[model samples]
Every structure is written in structure tokens, then in C-alpha cells.
Target: MDLQESFINSPDHHRIPLLSWAPQTPTAVLVIAHGMAEHAARYQPLAQWLNQHQVAVIAVQHRGHGPHCPDADLGHYADKRGWQKVVDDLQQVVVHARKQYPDLPLTLFGHSMGSFIAQAFTQKYGDQIDNLILCATNRVDKPKLRASLVLVRSIKALRGKRHRSRLIDNMTFGTFNKAFVPNRTSHDWLSRDPQQVDRYLKDPLCGFSCTAGLWSDFIGGMLDINPRVWRKDLPVHLLAGSCDPVGEMGRGFSRHVTNLRAAGVKVASERLFEGARHELVNETNADEVWHHILNCLRPETHSVTE
Candidate 1:
């Protein structure tokens, strides 16, 4: 694998660190939107595997994430218009990809929080991408999202935008781990693979709580996504874990697909792993997931959830 490192200048002059894995004469290029609280390095194995198949990979460390965070504080997006900036940051990545891998088909692969960013990107720039893959995504109820914003606002008013409130953190992610009682780690819901779970727990940048303002921005972005009015003629592939609590144990994922269909996605495909959890890319059957993803490039959308 040929690895390259560079820095992209965001609209606001933020220095966004980029990681690339390229194979000579690539077939396609993949621009990755990584999940929240984790950097782009975690996706190295997947990138390396894709390079072997002649698919190049490019990923960026988001505004408030990774060791090279240049603008916002750790666990925080900007205090205002943070979500929109995150979306813009993604666009910057796409722009970089277009120039770096010119004339190649591009796919946007987003996981968890990055899925929300990717969804918003498709809504804003549907004409730019060739394919969209949303993994571990969910539908957001508008009412709950509004209430969450209210709570985040109240907390921010009291604790400040940069404050890391345990109350807010627990309110957001506390229950996901409960699905697996007698758990060995707090992020057991991330994967069934113990080594992967341990890796996340050990990484300093993996599981930190975001600030109140960042939560407000994230949920605001979610509110903008669900029931979103957008149309695209491209293939959209949805992937998730059957028992993943983030999607409310699969109901939320279903609603998201329904929403996308209602919003006029031309070809939509879905697949759920029976016993898998969040972070399908890091799960034990990750190779299968990767192969399944490659199969989707053929432009056939299936309704079956196998």
C-alpha cells in the first residue's frame, strides 16, 4: 500500500489532516467520512484491503477529531453553525478527492455519526457522488430531536459551550451499552469482537464525550436529515447491526430507509448482520461486509435484508 499524508485547508482556514492509501492505476476512489470521536487512522485496515482490490481510499480527520485538530477543541465542533461546518468540511474532502483521483468513480462511505454527515452531504450534493453507503445510520424523530436541542441549550446556558457534562453524555450514549449486560467494556455495543472493543477502549481519542454545543449541532444536523426533501438517481446502500441500540434495535434504521424511499432515492439496498453491533467495519465479519460493499458497485439494488 502506498500511504500519503497531506493537509487540506477548510473554508474557515481550519487545517484538516488527510490520509490516503493508493494503488497504482486504481479502478475507483473512496472518500471516507469517519464516525464521531475517532480519527481516520482506524480505517487503515479497510483502506489497505481496498487498495489490494485497486480501489484507492482517502479519509480526513474531522474538525474536532483526531490528533491534528487545528480549529475546535477536543470533543467539540464550533460553537455556532458547527453542524453545517462539518458538512462543509466533508465537501472539502470530496473536492480534494475529485482533484486527487480525477476521472475515477467516487463513493462516499460513512459510519455512525459520519453517516449523518454523509446523508447531509448527499442531500446537499447528490449530483456529485457516484454511490452512497450509509452504515449504522438511524432515523431521528423530529420531536425528540427538538427536545434534545432544548436540553442541550439549557445545559449550554448553564455549563458553557465547551463544558463536558456527564449528564448530557449519559443522556445521549449511556443506554447503548445496557443491551449487553455483564459487559466487559463500556463500548461493547460497538462490536462483538473483544479485541476490537478493547482497541476502542484503549485509544485515547476513541470514546470521549462531546461538549454541549457539539451535541446541539449534531442533533440539529439529525433534525435536518430525517424526512429530508431530496432526490437522487444513484444507488444507496444501507448497512447496520440487527441488535444495534443506536437504531433502537433496528426500528430506527427501518424508518430511515422508509424516509429515503419517500424522499425519492431511485435504488436503495439494505443488509443487516444478525448478531453484529455498531461499527460493522470493525466487526468479526468485516471482510464479508467489505465484499458485500464491493458487490454494490454493480448498480443492482435488492429489497432483501440478507
Candidate 2:
């Protein structure tokens, strides 16, 4: 597999970093949108795995993420229009991938926060990609989300856009660790594997708090995409962990699938890993997760080629 790094110049002049892995003979292309407060490099293992299976992978780091982002801050998509700009960044990456490999069928894979972006992207550009994969995501309750946004916005107004609010962070993520009481780390909710949790904790970019402005923008984006009509014919695959708090232990995942089906979407498949956490790709049973994903991507094949 060949691994490469490059940068794309967004129209707003923000330099977005991308990491890509390609095999000698590729069968398909997968573009990844990573979850919040993390960089594209974290997905290297997943990318390498896909590459070895004759799939090319390209992953983009959001505006406030990765080492090459112009700003040194850990989280802040932008002072204004941050969420839209992130969506635009995904569009730009998709255009680039299409140009680079016009013949390969393209699939968009997103996890957690990235899954929200992927849903919005499909609503806007459903025709651009052949399939969609949403992992570790749920259909958020609009009322509660709006209330949280209002509170965050008020805090932003008082402390300024760049202010990082531990209050907001706690309100959003504090309870996730509650499920694993006597946990070794605050991020134990991320995976069952202690090594993965430790690695994430040690990574400077993995667990930082985002600016209030980012929270406001993210909530706004979530509200905007929640009610919009999605294309009925788009093929979608939803994956979640049975123990993932974000998915409400699979209840939210089921509701999301029901919503899509109600909207006339063709949900190709849905799977909930019984013992996994929020980050399915990094779980102890990650190989099983990958097996399910491979099956979804290549339904015609019975087994993954070595």
C-alpha cells in the first residue's frame, strides 16, 4: 500500500490536510470523515486495512484538526460559518477523489460527529457517491440540542467565540463515562480496549475541548440537517455499537433507520456490534466490525480476500 499526504486549498483560504492510502490495484475508493477533536492520521490503521483489500482510502482533517491546519488551536472550525465550511470541505474532497479515480465506485464513511456531516452531505450531494456508511451515530433530539445550543451561544457571547468551555464539554460528554464506573480514563467509553483508550488519551489532538463557537456552529448544523428531506433512493448502511451511549445503546440507531425508511430511503443494512463502544473501528472486536463493513461494501462476495 502507498500512503501519501497532501493539502487542499478551500475557497475561504483554509488549508485542509488529507491522508490517503492506495493499493497497486484498487477495486473501490472510500473517503473517510473522522469524528470530532481527532485528526485524519488516527484512521491510518483502518485505511491500511482497506488498502490491503484492494480499496483506496482518503481521509480529510477538519478545519481545526491535524498538524497542518493553519491555526494551532485544537478545535474551532472557524469564527463564523464554521459548520457550513466543514461541509464544503467534504464536498471539495469528494470532487478531488472523483477526479483522481473516475472509474472506482466511491463510498463515504463517517463516524460519530463525522456521521452527522455525512448525513448532511448525502442530503445535498447524494448523487455524487454510490453508497453511504454511518457509524457510531444517532438521530439527535432537536429540542434538547437546540436548548444546549442556546446555552452554548449565550456563553460564547459572554466569553467570546474562542473561549473553551469545560461546562459545555461536560454537559455534552461527561455522562458517557458514567456507564463504565471506576474507569481508568475519562475516555473509556470510546472502546473496550485499554490500549486504544490509552493511546487516545496520550494523543494531544484526541481529547481537547472545542471552542464555544464550534459548539454553537455544530448545534446549528445539526438543527439545519435534522428536518431537511433526504433522497429516497440513496443506499445507506448504518453501524453502531450496542453499548454506545451516543446511539443510546442501539435504540437511537434503530430510530434513525426507521426515519430513513419512512422517508423512503433504501437502507441496505444495519448492524450493532454487541460488545463494542462508540468507536467501532477501534474496539477490541474491530476485526468483526471490519468484516461487516466489507460485506456491506461488497455484497457480491462471500469472504474478504487476504
Best by TM-score: 2
* lDDT, model 1: 0.84
Consecutive 10-residue window with the lowest summed lDDT within model 1: 297-306
What is residue 65's positional error in candidate 2, in angstroms?
0.7
Per-residue accuracy of model 1 over 25-138 as CA lDDT, tens digit each: 788888899988788999999999888777899997887899876434888988788999989888998998999888988999998999989989888887788888988988
How far residue 202's Cα lies from its native spot in candidate 1, in Å, is 0.9
- Per-model TM values vs. the true structure: 0.94, 0.96
Lowest summed lDDT over 10 consecutive residues: which window, candidate 2?
297-306
Error of 2 at 56 (Å): 0.3
Which pairs clash inside model 2?
none
Give the distance in Å from residue 1's predicted Cα in candidate 2 to where it truly belongs: 1.3
For candidate 2, what is the lDDT? 0.86
Those runs of model 1 whose alpha carbons end farther than 4 Å from true positions after fitting are: 70-72, 226-228, 298-306
Instruction: State the C-alpha lDDT per candidate.
Output: 0.84, 0.86
- Pairs clashing within candidate 1: none
